[model samples]
Target: MSRRYCLVGNSHLAAPKLAWEGVRAEYPAVRAQFYGATRKQLGELEVKNGAFGAHLRPTSKKVSRAVKRVSGGSDKLKPGSFDAVILFSLGFNFHQAEAIYRTHRTLDFNGSATAEHLVSADCFRAALRSLLEDSLAVKLVRQIRQISDVTIMLSLQPYPSEAILKDGWKGWTTLKAEGDVGLLQETYISAAADIAEAERFDVIYQPVDTLNSEGFTKQDFCENARRLDLAAGDVHPVKNYTHMNADYGERVLQQLFAADAP
Candidate 1:
C-alpha cells in the first residue's frame, strides 16, 4: 500500500503544497494531502474521536471556505490513518531566537560585544527552551499525540530571505552586524535537534543550497511568493522576505523524500 502523508500548518504550507504537485509523480509509492489555515485559526484545530480539524459551520463561514480551499474539500484529517504527519510552520521560527538575542547576550556572541543583560549559557538555554515549548508547533504536537501515534515530522518556517537584511529589519541587521547570524543558525539547528529528541518527532530543515552564506534563504527563492489562499492569487507584496516561492518548496521536498531522510 502507498504511504499516506498529511502536511498541516499555517501559510508556509503553501510552499510544500505547490511543490508536491510537481514531485508527486516521482514518488509513486507515496500519497500526500495538505491542510492549512491562518496562524490564528491553526490553533483552533481540534482532534476528536481520532480525527483532527477546525470546526466548519455557518458562524465560521470564512474559516470554512479556507478549509475547503486549502484542503481540497476536506475539513478534517484522521492522522492515525496516515503513514506520516508533517507539521510545517506552526510558529517555530528564528525570530524568536533573535528576540532573545536582542535583549540578552550569550557567550555564543564572540568578541567584546557588551549587552547590559548578559546571560549565562544555562540561562540562554532555558530561554530558548521556554520559547520552543510555548510555540504553536509544540502545542499542536502534544494535541496530536493525544489521538495518534503516527510518525510526526516538523519543518520550521522557511528562513527569511537574504533580502531581509537589505530591508533593515532590526532583528536581522543586529544579528548580522554582531556577526551572530551564523551563531543564530547553529542555535536554531541545535534547538531543533533537542526538541525532536524530547518530543519524539523528525525535523526537516531547508536544503542547504537554498540558504545564503549568512543562513538566510537565497533571494531568488523568495520572489513572487504566494500566501496560503493561493487560488485567490494572494501573492506577497514586494520585499516580502518571510514567504518563499515554489522553487524553494521543490528543493525542500526533494530532500525530504530522498531515500535517506528521516
Candidate 2:
C-alpha cells in the first residue's frame, strides 16, 4: 500500500513540496498532501484534535481557503488517516539562536569564575538548550502530539548558511572551539529532541555530510541561496540563505526516508 505523508509548515514547505513531485517519481507508491501558510497568514488557524480547525473571522478567508484546499474541503484534517507527518522548518531557528548568543555577553565572570569557566562549551550548550526548550517551536511539537500519535518528526533546516561559516569574531569567539559553533548547535537540537522525545516525537537535523567543517551548510547544497546583505557598517557577514532548492530538498527527504527505514 502507498504510504501517505502530510506536509505541514509555513513557507518552508515550498521547495519540499516541489521536490516531492520528483520524489514520487522514484518512490511511486508514496503520496503527499501539503498544508501551509506564511506567518502573516497562520494566525487564523488552530490545531484541534489532530487536525487544523479554522478561526473564522471576517479576515479569515485566505486561511479558510488553505485549510479547505489542503484538507479536501473538510473543516479539519482527517484524523488517523495519514501514515506520517513531516513538519519542515517548524523548529528552532538557528539563525535567531546565533543572534541571541551574539547579542548577549553571557560570559562576564565578575571575578568569581575562572577564565576557563567562561569558555566552557557546557555553559554555552546549556544556555542554548534552555533557550530552545522554551521556544514556541518546541511547544508546538508537544501540542501536535496532543492530537496525533502517528510518526511525527520535528525537522530543522541545515544549521546555518555557508556564508556565516567563517564569521567567528563578531563577539563570542572565545566560547567556541576551532571557530566551530556545532557544539552549541547540537545543544539546541538535543534540547528540542528531549522535549519531543517525551511525547514520542522525533527530531531530525540536516545530514552531517551536508555541513562544512564549521558546521554551517555547504555551499554546493545551497543552490537557491542569496546573500544576506546588511546595512552599511553593520556586521552581518553571512552571505547565504538557509532556504534551499528542490534538489537539496530531495536529498533531505531521501535521508529522512532512509532513517525511517527498518
Candidate 3:
C-alpha cells in the first residue's frame, strides 16, 4: 500500500500544497492530504476522540470552511489517518530569537565586540530554546503524541526575503550590518534540530538553493507569494516577505520527497 501523508500547517501550507497539486501525478506511489488554518486557529485545533478539529464557536464556521477548502473538503483529521504528518510553519521560525537580538547581542554575534548590552551565550541559547519549546509547532507535535505516535516532520517557515534588508527592518538591518547572520542562522537551525531529536521527530530545513548569501530566501522565490486568505493563483501584497511563490514550493516538495524516498 502507498504511504499516506498529511501536511498540516498555517498559511505556509499553501506553497507545498499548490506544488503537490501540480506535480502529484508523477509520484504514483504516495498519497497526500493537506490541512491548513491561520496560526491562531491552528493553536485552537484539538484532537478529540481521535478526530482533529476546531473548537465550537462563532468563528468555527469560517475556520472549518477554510480548512475544508484547503483540505479538499475534509474539515477534520484523525490522528491515524496518515502514515506521516508534516507540520509546516505553525510559528516555527527564528523570529523570536531574532527579536531578542534586536535588544541584546550575544557573544557569538560578529558585531558583539563593539555592541552594547551584550548577553551571555548561555542566556541567548536558553532564550531561543525556551521560545522554540513554547511555540505552537512544538505544542502541536506534543499534542499529537498524546494519543498516537505518528511520524512527524517539521518544516520551518521560509526565511524572510532578502528584500527585507532594503527596507531597513530593524532586526534584519542590524543583523546584516553588524551581527553574525551566519551564526544566528546556525544557532536557530541547531536549536530546532536538537528539539526535534529530543522529541523524536524530524525536520526538513529549506533547500540550500532557496537561501541567499545572507541566509534569507532568494528574492526570485519571494515574488507573487500567496496568503492564506487568497484564492488559488492569487498573489499576496508585494510587501509580504514571509510567504513564498509556487516555484519555491516546488523545490521544497522535491527536497521533502527526495529525503522521504525509499
Candidate 4:
C-alpha cells in the first residue's frame, strides 16, 4: 500500500506541488496531499478533536479557493493518518532571513573564530528564537503536533531565486543578496534547524547542487522566475516571483523522501 502524506503551506507550496505532479509516477507507493491557504488565512485553521480541519466556509473567496486548490477542501488530517506531514517553506523563510542579511556584516560562524563572528551568531540566535517562538511557523507546528504524531518536517523556504541576483531587481534585499548571501542562508538554516530540533521536528535545507557559489538558487531550477529591468522611471515593475520549476520541486520531494526512509 502507498503511504499517504499531507503537505501544508502557503504560496510557497507551489514548488512541491509542481514537482509531485511531474514525478509521482517514479514513486508508485507514495501518495501526497496538500492543504494551503493565503498567509493571512492560516490562522483560520481550526483544531478539532486533535486533528486539523478546514472549516466549511471561509470569510473570503480567495481563502476558500486556496483551501480547495490542493487537496479538496475537506480532507481532514488526523493523527497517524499518513507516513509524514511536511510543512513546506512557511514561517521562518525570508521574513526572518532578510533581517539578518540587513544587520549581520561578513561574520561567518562556519569560518575561523572572531569576536565579530560571535556577535553575529548571538544576534542570529536571538532572531531565530523570536521567529520560532513568536512567528506563525511555531504556532502552526504547535497545532500539528497536537493533532498528529507522524514524523513532522519543517522545510524552510528556498533562498531568493537567481532572479533576485539579476540587475532587473532593484530591491534592497537583492543588494544584500549580492554580498554574503551564502552565509546569510546558512545562518537562517542553522537557526531554523536548532529550533525545529527543540520542537522534535526535522528540518530540511536546500541541496548544495541546486545552489550557486553565493548560495542563491541556480537559474536552471528557476525557469519561471522573473525580475524587473531598468526603466525610464525609477518604478520597479512587478515581476513573477516564481522560484522553482518542476525539476527543483522534484529534487526537494526526493530529499524529503530520503529523510523519511529508514
Candidates in order, TM-scores: namely 0.91, 0.72, 0.91, 0.78
lDDT of 1 by residue, 91-201 (tens): 888878878888887876862266658888778777987898788888878877877778888887888998889999876787788888887678777888898889888
Error of 4 at 169 (Å): 5.1
By TM-score, the best candidate is 3
lDDT tens per residue, model 3, 64-140: 87788778787776657678888998888978778777777777788787666799988888888998989888988
Clashes of each: 0, 0, 0, 0
Model 1 segments more than 4 A misplaced: 50-62, 259-262
Rate residue 219 of model 4 by lDDT: 70
What residue runs in model 2 are displaced by over 4 Å at the alpha carbon? 49-59, 66-75, 104-130, 133-136, 165-178, 225-240
Q: Which regions in candidate 3 have their CA more than 4 angstroms from the true location? A: 50-59, 114-116
Ranking by TM-score: 3, 1, 4, 2
The models' CA-based lDDT, in order, is 0.79, 0.57, 0.81, 0.64
Across 164-244, the per-residue lDDT of candidate 4 in tens digits comes to 647465443454535555566666667777788777788877777787776667777777522111111222233434456
Q: Candidate 2: worst 10 consecutive residues by lDDT?
A: 227-236
What tens-digit string does per-residue lDDT give for candidate 2 at 49-76? 4223321211377666655554445434
Question: Model 4, 78: alpha-carbon shift in Å?
Answer: 2.6
Instruction: For model 3, give the 10-residue run with minimal summed lDDT.
Output: 50-59
